[model samples]
Target: MKPVLLSVLALSGLLSTSCRQTTSQAPSQAEINAIGLKRGSITMCGPAQGQKLGTASFGTSCPAAAQPDFNLALSLLHSFEYDEAEKVFARVIAREPGCAMAYWGVAMCSYHPLWTPPSPAELTKGAKAIALAQRLAGKTNREAAYIRALAAFYQDWNRTEHKVRALRFEQAMAAVHAQYPQDSEATLFYALALDAAADPADKTFVKQKKAGFLLQALYPGQPHHPGILHYLIHTYDYPELARLALPAARQYASVAPSSAHALHMPSHIFTRLGLWDECIASNRAATESARCYAASAGLPGHWDEELHGLDYLTYAYLQQGQNQLARAQWQYLDTIRRVSPVNFKVAYAYAAIPARYVLENRLWQQAAHLPRHPGPLDWQQYPWQAGIIHFTRALGQAHLGQPDSARREVAALRGLHSELVRQKDAYKATQVRIQLLAAEAWTLLAEGKAAAAEQRMRQATDLEDHTEKHPVTPGEVLPARELLADMLLQRHRPQEALAAYEANLIKHPNRLNGLRGAATAAAQSGETAKAARYRKQLRKLAPVAPNPEAAAAHLSSYRRP
Candidate 1:
């Protein structure tokens, strides 16, 4: 279940980031899939109703009367404000009934290139809009080219797979860019298509690098262009590329201060670099903006962006050693009465935020008993979200001298893993597999099969290291390497455990578990200097977590028969 919190990075990936809520009877299977189970997101008809979406200026062949609204719609489109953009495009169409580009804008709003493939209904809607534009015929060659470029995705909608169609769209956009080298909009959109169509498994990041270079060139010309900043951030949101994205990250919040999504976006880079302070601030603003807008708009409840922001804020505080602040986030979540735009993204946030709180704070019993969903949230649609609940329970049970109970959780994860695979959701399938491996590893350890447990943990880390975290999360529920280090220490191999902690810290710098585990392992291994350094770093960050759950976890770990 690629639920909320992730954005354009849902599949082709506008990275996801949260949800809020009321509950009802479960939707049928068909209804759930029609929502966002397979697709990345559902349309938010007026998500940004009262907010100020940032700027764009598209010189179009549109009538003068329609130009300003067209620019506003186009600007919103750049920011991934599909719902509002579509509405504005409709207004533009009303003003100039024959404006082919206005129809094209409607089609463009449905094309979430960075997100997962559209649902069947979404596909048909976009296809019909583009078909209308085609029939109307653009007044200028450039307008015609723009309409034709979007046509690539809709042409074979029924028969062609999403990625194949995405590539065709990218190719068509490339032609539009090559033909009109001076067209900045074409250049920018093409760059996005490159990142959107780029293979996630391609660690070389060849496409990302190229896309970044293109965005950089366009940045100076339109300094506050939301798309330019937003796409640049997305293009370089990689471990190796994060430092390069610092400028864009720092600029994004100010560029579109009124946009909850824009306010939240900078944290994506901050999270990658372990810049907890910036991350916390970003999410704070994002959550507040989202909540205010949702209330003013009189929506059912908080927007998904609000929940996504809270999830990140909680993570940042915990990483910064502000355990109490992290605790407060869940307190806020408890008060959510309902979530508007109920879909996968919101469902993901519902499952993940609470799980993160317990697991990160090491509240094993709490982790074990986490409710499947908030009363208002739907879980029947998202089996992968269910997988998270089971995985955390497995960890809690494994440490609490309940190996059989832990195994039961592991069994549930296996079933969920298979379900994700059957649905062809590769990202969530891999995530479930990672959880299954780690859960089974702990179960094996609890059963006194230490070597097998270590082997499984190692496999988990290997697989986890290969893929990027989904945009919805700040980081893993727990880094697999941290788990491996914990296992090493449990077996009394401090030197090996110290090595594992050191390696993980290199990739995920300054993580609370990484620092604490390293400090403990280094001291046990007689590396006093290394131990002191870690402790000093922790002290500089903040005090240790105030909760007693970590101590309780230790007691439970030792309770193994």
Candidate 2:
């Protein structure tokens, strides 16, 4: 699962940091051939309504196919368009009376964010729906089998215990994948389950390897397949592999402009390659197409799901130093938040806007506050959101000279994994665990335990490396490297710090933090001229003076040594 919070850097920002380029053995033709690539858009056999039902329409009958409104409703529920999806399903229940999918769709859609879950009532309705869908499964066909599998998935999703729900969802998804291996939707959904698992530290490694094997066996050229490139780019730094994937990512985005998954990615690659013009152009095109999608949906009287596009565009703007455009976009996001206020989706808008400003202006204190919430908001309840907030809190507190408070906040966040499992938030719980490992390692580094910290940090990075193959952002990995580099420098391991910083620079050369870290490492290692050169680059990049020693002192203000 790409940490959604990482949208801050995916689009266009350039890191003016260190330079360490290491070449690896080029990918062999056989290795490249193993990446089963899909051509054109994700092909679905259902109906035109099936696509909408699959992607959007869930609640009501929006004229999907002929007989089975329930089937169409099932498709909509799978795509997460719960409101309209639910209405369609309710109609099916009214007519068929015992149609199991209708009840299942109700359950699935009920738990969906579009409808919002405030109390346990929604959970009950979802359970009832799941029971109905299961009962209806007694009499079925190929379509019914597929639908039944989905019903099981949703039922498991709503279970109060996250671990159980995740396992059930995984089982259902696995069944679907086994039965219909060619079903990209099934495969993608299965991947999503892996992405959401509670203890994915190991599972991510296992799943990505599995996904790679499966992708090779089933489809070979669909580089644009949602998660394949994400996995490869993040896990290893094989430039040849990334080069081979370039065409696939580009073609995928071109073919499926409206797909949120497809649009931001090619642009992401472009950003990484320092192709500013290409990144900006792709973002512009994506933003335009997303606008059209929102207009057509006509939900909430505006674009309902284009936050993804807006996020991409925001990153693009920040990277190009088009802060003015980024500010305008932030304002627009604020207006949308005020007018719509749908779910926690707006937190991206709120968090990103200020984060960009803080980063750009070097306002560490302000940035720190943006990520700390007094309590979980509706969206903040997500494991990913909770992780992001906690990380942000750590970052803010660290910058504000409160390492002790930062340590405690991070510890409290680590405790959320247990609660997450209890709350049936398996997907989020797993992600949080990954972050917690990284955060704890950083805390140990701050506490001057270099050897122990490095061990934990490497473990965290290794797990991230194993899973980098699935479709998720590599932001966490970059930060982990940076923290390690800083730790190495503090421990007088300048060579190791330099090596790590250089490696990260290859992946994210424009990151100001990486640049700053390189400069600081150089200075501490007695390489004055090298340090001076990096400092010049850093100043050009961020133009701020952050005295680490002074910052450390400030950290003392918030908590104990």
Candidate 3:
């Protein structure tokens, strides 16, 4: 019965193609129910309800008894609950002592392909797990093949470069995928490996596009597959491709409602498109979900996932001008810090929340008076997080007519840039340098050196234009180019300021400051037509109160529309 069921599943997978549109008809309820059944009894040979298909199956050569616990473990792995997945996979190993794939699950959790490279400790642990799997008896050829693919990822720690190792693992997965053309899990894992091996400097996103195509094909039959939707959101998490992923982003939370990351994933698209309402709702749900998970697990503090959601929530609230709500979130962040352990996520929020509150509200005096080392988190370890605080302080001090203090921050930023360069972190080095240039420009402007300030600010803006923000933080506290536009407006260069604001809108899209600056610069330049259009957009963004007629009359004077 198991063999027959396996054959039927393979045949069904073979009928699917990689080009099928997401809107194509989905599998029927009966067909889905039959996916993991043998002799009318549900088995754990494949994914069950809410479980993504993993590269493990029960068959003649692999005679380990099917247990629901194994499927639950795979589901947790798909949702990236690494700690939980590791424990559950251990249970599967204890029950089925010869299950080679159980060790594979443990190794995969440590890799964290999308987030960051494995730490040395994680690599050692994964290598040990793979060695154990290799010694297990009765492992099927396919199961051995799966283990071999992951072995390539954890093979050489001190010798091979990280990207070179990733490419090696990708090549192994490609071969596994070819060997089992009808295995949906093989295709899915191959797609992820392709994405993991993609060159970050290649803006064309060739590997990402290929992965997206495979996930799209898998979606028509397995519409609610958590891995497919989650990977799809990640593949298109850029300005140009975000809209194309709206369908997956919109459906993922519903498909895996129990997973906090699943709930949080949709907001990537929402943030990219500036869909503030949707972004707010998604992060709100995600925060609550993360809190509940932490509480149920009896953890001592709020999980990093909760802080991550709050970062997105705060950004959306500020964009919508809900300062009261944003301030409330800022207060909650301090509470979390008091109770939570200091980690990268906590440190990032510790810096970003205050930076956003002061800069977005334009409270220059408060920003200027901020502490040099504000929090207890190790600034030396996470210099990029520290850079946020210094950047804000520099901007505020310069704006408050304190050139000396601002210049001090400029020097500090240069030191930070030099430190990152020594650490061989090119991305953060570039980011800190951009901040240094902006700080210098603002300080020069405070000294009434308009021409020199413009030159420095333009250099900062041009460098910033070529780079994209890292995925770890929601965005920078404030964009440097936007500051350049503000400085241009102050210098009575309305035309250049308008162009700067327009370019910012292309990258940021519907940011409140960008919209407001573009409108004011247009009005000052006597571009009444453009001013009216921008004013109309502003009105749509935030409606005025207590004399709608007066507001309409003021805007009407700009154009005869």
Q: Give lDDT: candidate 3, residue 222.
A: 80
For model 3, state the Cα shift of residue 96 in Å: 1.6
lDDT per residue for candidate 1 within 435-546, as digits (tens), equals: 9999999999989898899999999999988877777677788889989988888788889989999988877877877888899899999999999999999887666644
lDDT of 2: 0.50
Candidate with maximal lDDT: 1
Candidate 2 segments exceeding 4 Å error? 1-140, 154-160, 172-199, 212-248, 258-304, 316-332, 339-341, 356-361, 368-474, 487-493, 505-512, 515-561
All candidates: TM-score: 0.88, 0.58, 0.83
- Model 1: residues >4 Å from true position, as ranges? 1-53, 551-561
Full-model lDDT, candidate 1: 0.77
Tell me the tens digit of each residue's lDDT in model 3 across 1-561.
011112333322322221122321323334322322111111111113633332222232323353565666666667676776677666665555456677677888778787656777777777767655655556566776777778766766556556666776777777778888777778888988988877655678888898888888888888867788888888888777889889988998877777778888899888888888899999999898888767766667777888888889999887876777888898887766433445667777777887887777777777887653344566888777778778889888887789999988888888888898887667778888888888899888888887898899988887877666666666667887898888878777789889999988877887877887899899999999999999888877755331343334323322211
Rate residue 102 of model 2 by lDDT: 51
Off by over 4 Å in 3: 1-67, 338-342, 372-376, 544-561
RMSD of each: 8.7, 14.9, 11.0
Q: Which TM-score value belongs to model 3?
A: 0.83
> What lDDT score belongs to each candidate, Candidate 1 first?
0.77, 0.50, 0.72
What value does the lDDT take at residue 112 in candidate 2? Answer: 42
Q: Each candidate: how many clashes?
A: 29, 42, 0
| Residue-by-residue lDDT tens digits, candidate 2, 273-359 | 545556667766656655655555443533434554565566656545455676677667655532132444444434444445444
Worst 10 residues of 2 by lDDT: 11-20
In model 3, which range of ten residues has the least summed lDDT?
37-46
